[model samples]
Target: MIDPRTPVLVGVAQFVDRDSLSADALSPLDLLAAVSGAALADSGGRGVVVDTLAVVRLFADSSPAFRSPFGSYANLPKSLAARLGQAPRRTIYGPVGGNTPQLLVNLLAESIRSGASDVALIAGGEALRTQARAQKMGLALDWSEDPGGEPETLGPETRLVSAHEVAHGIAMPTAVYPLFESALAAHYGDDPLAHRRRIGALMAGFTRVAAANSYAALPVERTADELITPTDDNRYIAYPYTKYLCSNMFVDQAAALLLMSTAAADAAGVPVSARVYLHGSADVHDMILVSQRLDYHSSPAIRAGAAQALAQAGIGVAELDHIDLYSCFPVAVEIAADMIGLAHDDPRGLTLTGGLPYFGGPGNAYSLHAIAEMAARCHAAPGSKGLVFANGGYLTKHSFGVYSTDHPANPARIDPTLLQAALDAAESPPFVESPAGAGTVEAITIPHERGIHGPATVIVRLDSGHRALAVIDTEAAALIDTQVVGRRVNLTPGHPINHARFE
Candidate 1:
């Protein structure tokens, strides 16, 4: 039996790939209206109006003028109100994070369970490509970024990384992900070449999916060699990751969801077609600094949160008809798969929208696309279930949810904060760089004065050595002239350390 407290997801919508917004092309506001209408329509053409609206970032709409007390994205809350033609009982200009979509849904579900509101809507969009094209074509557009008035005071708990991280070489996504990639390679005792090949094969699967997904931003299938091979067209962005394996954020797309209480859905007469229930959700975060992590190979947040969510939904990985693991890089997918015990080649596939790399990472909101696809899958599969995983701020945080067409057995909502607390207390060890000893050379990323450079490869070690990543410090020099990839090397700590090729 469906628990009385169970919250039903009645509507979902998404948009993608437009060079320009045609007359039929929904403007940001119009897009919101259409999706809201679609959600309500899906809910059996229910007459119910939203009382609460949670507006996630409209990526293409981030104009300097839209800044407000709620930060730059606050305008979404008020703008959604105007578009929907109703006074929201409450409006949230959510904090920035890729996990915002699922987080907002979790908050709305709690509110419904608490009787704080009867119906709510969560929406987000990105039009980076569209705006760029419009400007290049000399079309005048009035996208507002300034949301007038004093900004609301941000809460004390939220912390952004220091400028030093950015000033240094660690701020970029490709750079950041390599920290985990290198660690995982070392942990697994694999040579850089083998690791690169594995990652290439994994991401090629996503590219194949994107080729089939109409909404994919880079909808072209990349061969494993094309993906991992170090060539001018596909250069190494980081040591273990190449350009094709990284997330693609430069795209135009948006997605929205309509969530209503079961009581509200019943009152509106929304049909079975539009209804997907939240069986369970778990939200958690790892330690803030990647350097401070106890274990680089695993994400405790993913393991704990995913377990809790699946347990709450009363289902196992094998039973889920659809699964959408976050795929910003191969490590994200590998960590998720390892934690959840899903086969890398599971027939269900790892993503519902190709993945962030091909589907496009809309900053912190790409998972919204995943959730939308998962909802559609539930609709298509009828009694089956779906899972959506979202990551935020450098894999530092994670949230997982399970949904189904069946009524939820346990109607109560578990506090995600409790899960976050557990993660906070979990112990992790510090990652210490190894002092050079005899070992094999593997793939490496070297920072240069101009740009990040590499032609990384696998190398064997001599004299009871250890394998470690290496980079040659040079000024835009040729790859062959650079220090050895196959020769033995001394890694003495000194000026920029050393990777001298031993005869």
Candidate 2:
């Protein structure tokens, strides 16, 4: 018999506003309420009490690039709670990371299973596109609110890039993901042109799904050439990554999820067709710093997390009927698929909501929408299995969940410490702040200026087997056309950061 305390998702909702300039544009608070109301109605809950409410960190507050000129909300959850007429016993605000949504659901489900809580609501939204348009058009907008109390915080907030990596002009996702792309290409022994074509075709599949998704920000389907080829509209953000390859964060989107015990679902008369159980779940993180990673092409965290979740679900990768691997960039998907034992071009399909690049990556809450979409899929096809893998930071943090319409025999949440400790104790290469002399390139990222080539940033392994970061200025044609990984280079330590020249 299934545990009465087992957590099941009863309701989920998503919202997308394409017209930010409309007279009735919703603010962040309004967006949360919109999704929350829809989710509550979807659950068919009548006078159901919520003991916990959690809100994912917003993009504007997470990064300076998305920073809003408007004042901040003192307590984001309280604001949402007050707006929704919810006085949950515990209010929570999640930390900054794309994995926060799935991580929260996994942990909160464990809470419900343990009877620590009854019903819980998770919600998040982003008005970034609206905020940007207002700012650019010199229009006044205010997202600030004071709800009068501090909420308990969940998850970690760490500085992703190190001082050294930033010094070498490697800071944002656009610059860093290309490092993985280049390394992955070298790992597969593929040429630059062929690799581009391969990744282009791979991501083209996502666009096709996006074209059909009403919630997708970039909903137009694109081919391999339309995706990878550098044109005026599709400029190269970084080598091996065109503008289309990156996640589209400039979209107004929101999503919310409602979870409660199976007993609670039955008490509320939530229909069996609307209920989706958590078959398995796992969350883990790798070395935080980009330079401290074991390798560029793969994520140890993904491998470990997926293994734990799959084991708990009493299923293997081969059995998963529906899947959505986080797709912030091509390498993120490539690495996740490689580590999780899913094929890059699996006929079963890789994304449920097109993915981050095509679907609106609404800050840390993108996976919530993916999970919501998964619930709808499971509801349509009973007994079908689905897996959602979410990544945060530079593929350093991971969260995986296995879901199904069929009730599981046993609880699937397990202590991740055992496997997580093993990954934590895994050795990483020694790092050097500054270095001189001969070394070999592990990966390289070239920045483009106004669609033209800029200086190239390189990650090198010194003759002493120590990793270092450096930069070199050269003709675009020199490094652009040819694969430079494994090429010899001489490094020279200098102020600000180290410099390297091709040898």
Candidate 3:
């Protein structure tokens, strides 16, 4: 018999608002309330009782660029709950990271397993598409609110980017992710042009998946060549990455999930067919800074997290019937698939809600949609197992969960603290902030802003057996056209940022 305290997901709801624009656009808060209410109603009326309510961090609150101009909420979680007429004993405001959704699941599962929470209502949404429209058209919006009462914050509020990275022009995901792709391209021994086509072909599969998903923002199917080749519509955002290849955060989307203990679900009269068990779950983080990592092409965190989650489920990657690896960029999916031992072209497929790029990247809440999708797939397949892998902070944080509809026995799980410590203790070279000498280029990114290529950002391994981040302030054309990984570059230490040039 399954443990009474075992947590199971009973309801999920997703929404995509494509029609609204400017002032008519629903705010993130509005979307959150609608989806949360829908999720609870999906759990069979008032059958499920929510003792805890968690809200994923919004894009506006998560980043400076997306900061809401119409004022702010004093208590976002409570703001959302009040709309549902709920006064949950515990209200949580999630931290900044795409890993948060799955992280919240693993955390709430532990809570339900311990009998701390009978049921939980978790929800979040993004209205950047609307926000952008308002800003560009000089329209007015009022997103401010004060729901009253303080809600506890969830997860770490750690800084996502370091000052050194900023100095080197590695300011955002678009710029940072290409560092990994460049290294991956070199590792694959493909020339600049071939590697572009190779990744283009890989992401073309995602576009096809998106075409079938009603919730997908860019639901239009695109060819491999169409994705890679730049034009007026598909311009290169950063080096080796076109606009189509990156995550589309500018979306008006929302999703909600309901989790309850088996006892609570049974008491709520939830159908057995509707319940999905959390068979395994784990969360892990790599060296917080990209500069501190040992390399750019791979992720130890993903390898460890995937292994641990599968171990807890008493299965292997091969045993999973369905899968969705976070696809913020092509490199993220490639590295995660490699780490988890799944083939790039696995017959079962790699995404559930298409991917972040196609389905829609709702800031820190993208994986929530992935989880909701995974639960639906589990219900459809009954005993079939599904896995959702969520990534955050430039592939720095990872969360994994295994799901199935059948009553599950205790599988196995390592103490997360123990796993984390081992990962933290992994051998890493010293990080050098200043450098002056010959260095081997480990990765290269020539960012494009406003339709023009840039002074390149380069990650280098100095002769001192340490890593240094530097910039090439000129000759944007040469760097963009050629493969620079493994090539020698000379560094000249400068104020604010160091400079690098081909030897």
Instruction: State each model's CA lDDT, in order.
Output: 0.68, 0.88, 0.88
For model 1, residues 1-503, the per-residue Cα lDDT tens digits are: 45444578888877776454442333455556666666656667446788888776554333343222222333666766776776776777666667778878887888898888888887776655655555566666555544443222123334434433333344455667766666576666666677777788778888888889887888898888898776676666665566778787767677778888888887888776788988888777888865445555688888888888888888888888899998888888887888888877787899889988787886567887888888888888888998898887767778787888888887576767777887788764422233355544433334322235642322223344333333334332344223334445555433333343433
Candidate 1 vs candidate 2, TM-score winner: 2
Model 1 global lDDT (CA atoms, 0 to 1): 0.68
lDDT of 3 by residue, 321-353 (tens): 989999999999999998999888888999988
Which window of ten consecutive residues has the lowest lDDT sum in model 3?
A: 406-415
Worst 10 residues of 1 by lDDT: 65-74
lDDT tens readout by residue for model 2, 1-503: 77789899999999998863864567888889899888988998787778899999898778888778877889989888888888999999998888989999998999999998889999998988888787788776777899798999964567888777898887888888898889899999988889999999999999999899988877888898999998899888888788898898878899999999988888888887888988899999989888998988888889989999989999999999999999999998999999999888999999999988888788889999999999989988999999999999888789999999999866857899898899889889999987989999998898886678778898999999999998875565578747888889999997877888888
Backbone clash pairs for candidate 3 read 312-412
Higher-ranked by lDDT: 1 or 3? 3
- In model 2, the Cα lDDT at residue 277 comes to 89
- Candidate RMSDs in order: 5.4, 1.3, 1.3
TM-score, per-candidate, Cα-based: 0.82, 0.98, 0.98
lDDT of 1 at 481: 25
